[model samples]
Target: MAIAKLDVVALDCPEPRKLADFYAALLGGALVDDEAENGWVVLSTPGGRLAFQESPGYRPPVWPSTEHGQQLHLDLTVEDLDRAEKEVLALGATALDTEDRSRSWRVYADPVGHPFCLCAG
Candidate 1:
């Protein structure tokens, strides 16, 4: 008797199309651009569906600080940490925490400042 099932994980951003493209490139998915349908974009991947909603006044959160905490973040697993890091950085992701290279995970911010992690699989 489950009351609900997880459908999609949506993120709010100033530009839905751009955000969707970024995720699509990172995760290997098919993007559905439907800005006319209420400023929403969907990315369909084997893992799941990721959506982006347009928020005109969206403000990115500051991580590790309660003043403006991270609203939420995605944890993406990769086969090779170094390779993934290089790819993501070239795709406009900012390194948030990469000082400790021995760790199993590293943090990075998407182009517009949404923090996400690249974890070793």
Candidate 2:
């Protein structure tokens, strides 16, 4: 028996709407923008749902460092690595790791500094 079910992955950021829009465009989802909701945004996609929470004092983590480690990172698989990288960079994602040509994955930091991988699966 499962104790609880995993619902949605929420990312904390200074601005919810902007972050939500970024993810919606990347994931091909609709941003559920409710005027009543003050500091949150939800993107509902065919695969799953992503929620962005507003944190006034949000501070992005520094990857590969123990002082401020990555809270969590999304591993997104793509059909073509080259194409995906081009698209993400245009969407304000910074390239974090793309040196190892032997590897099947590349790392990129989202607009809000959250690290995510573009994996070839």
lDDT string for model 2 (1-121, tens) is: 9999877898899888888878877889887653315887888877788889888899997876789899999999889998999999999999999989688999999999999999997
lDDT scores of the candidates, listed in order = 0.90, 0.86
Q: Runs in model 2 with CA error above 4 Å? A: 33-37
Query: Model 1: which ten-residue window has the lowest total lDDT?
Result: 29-38
Scored by TM-score, the top model is: 1
Question: Candidate 2 local accuracy as lDDT?
Answer: 0.86
- Quote the positional error of residue 81 for candidate 2 in Å: 0.4
lDDT of 1 by residue, 10-119 (tens): 98988888888888899997975566257899898778999999888899989867898998999999999999999999998999999999899999999989999999
* True-vs-predicted CA distance for residue 74, candidate 1, Å: 0.7
Runs of candidate 1 with Cα error greater than 4 angstroms are none
